[model samples]
Target: MTNTDPDIRRKAEEIIFGMWDTLTEDERKEISEHLTIEEFQKNEYIYKELEIPKCIKWLISGKVKICKSGVTGRDQILRTIVPSEIFSFRAYFANDDYLTSALSFGHSVVASVPMTIIDKLLHTNIQVCRKLIKQLAIELGKADSRTVSLTQKHIRGRLAESLITLKNSYGLEEDGYTLSIYLSREELANMSNMTTSNAIRTLSSFATDKIIAIDGRKIKLINEEELKRISENG
Candidate 1:
């Protein structure tokens, strides 16, 4: 949290204003003046589970995975966040520590806004408080849906849904099929709530059926309609 690059600052402001439009000129200026920009390398830990929240982070670019570790040290991915998304807000609002660990999937730039400033704004600004509540509600709904998808879906359906979710969250490349972000097979399994071997075999089956094409870590959707059908059926 030491950089002051103008481009990063501009993107941070854009994300804040886009999400919460009620900030006054003074409030905006105050935020801009106090914000700190930090760069994290791929696979870097942004925060660990049970750590106290120091700042609210807005991901300006790259991807981050929120995960929790089991007793055996296995990781379960809770959510993947992309640019313009805010993290650690829930912990700050609850006056508690982070429940999950956040890690950078790739080299990422994050804007760190002090919790003190956020708390002050929430106290004085009703609009900001309302926006935060709405955001939290939406996140909760998504979590519920994700839990159902992972627990109830079959192997094929679970993998397909995971791919669809990734595409929707990170978008597709210029080809309109390949995912913008590349994840390893193990990571995909973690996201899908399945074993890595099951994920790999299912992916192979999908490839054989021409539903998807895999090039190392990159997956290209070849039959999105069929994929969606399997997801919906299961």
Candidate 2:
């Protein structure tokens, strides 16, 4: 991995550690000294499944996908990581290797601080400990909800939920209806826990019903309310 420019590293630290203002000067300095920043190309793997956990990572820019290989070698996308979000700490905390792999969705910049430093902060700062615990709890809740949605929801409902999730995570383009992020049909299927063909068919059905419009990979929501209703009813 190539080292990031100092200016970029400083910017990432400001955004990521802005929430940890409670840390003392020495603690902050220690973190800065140990943090490493690297840039990843589009579709690159930041880390792979079964890799030993080394650091807590922050997505300084671009998007990341957290996924695991399914029984048939298909990938099941668990979540998308947005800019400034912290990740890759769960495995370290659990004393296990990474269960899922992290891949860059586009050209991305990531910053990593050693887990040992995080352990120190957790020991020395009560607030830091509480914040990390709260983050873990929130992630756990989302995982549980997704598990139920994938297992119980029909194909239409699952696809609707995935579209809603993307909109919520990345927002819409300037047109205000088209999704900002363009994902391939295979990626959509992985996220919804369905086959790519099923996702494409369901998306077409939505367009035919006037619930959405498809322009190549760009999906424009025509009836956001109806989509939400389907997701909720499922």
Residue pairs clashing in model 1 are none
TM-score of 2: 0.97
lDDT of 2: 0.91
- Over the stretch 1-234, how does candidate 1's per-residue lDDT look in tens digits? 456789888888899878878989888888888888888888899999999998988999989999999676889998999899988889877888898999999989888888999888998789989988988999999999988998898999999998998999999999999999999999999988889999999999999999999999999999999999999987
Residue 186, candidate 2: Cα error in Å is 0.5
Predicted model with the maximum TM-score? 2
TM-score for candidate 1, residues paired by index:
0.96
Tell me each candidate's RMSD, in Å, in order.
1.3, 1.0
In order of appearance, the predictions have TM-scores of 0.96, 0.97
**Residue-level lDDT tens digits of model 2 in 1-234:** 666698988887797579677888888899999989998987899999999999999998888999999999999999999888889999999999999999998888999989999998899999888988999999999999999999999988998999999999888999999998889999999999999999999999999999999998899999999999999888
Candidates in order have lDDT scores of 0.90, 0.91
Weakest 10 consecutive residues of candidate 1 by summed lDDT: 1-10
Q: Go through the candidates in order and give the clash count of each.
A: 0, 0
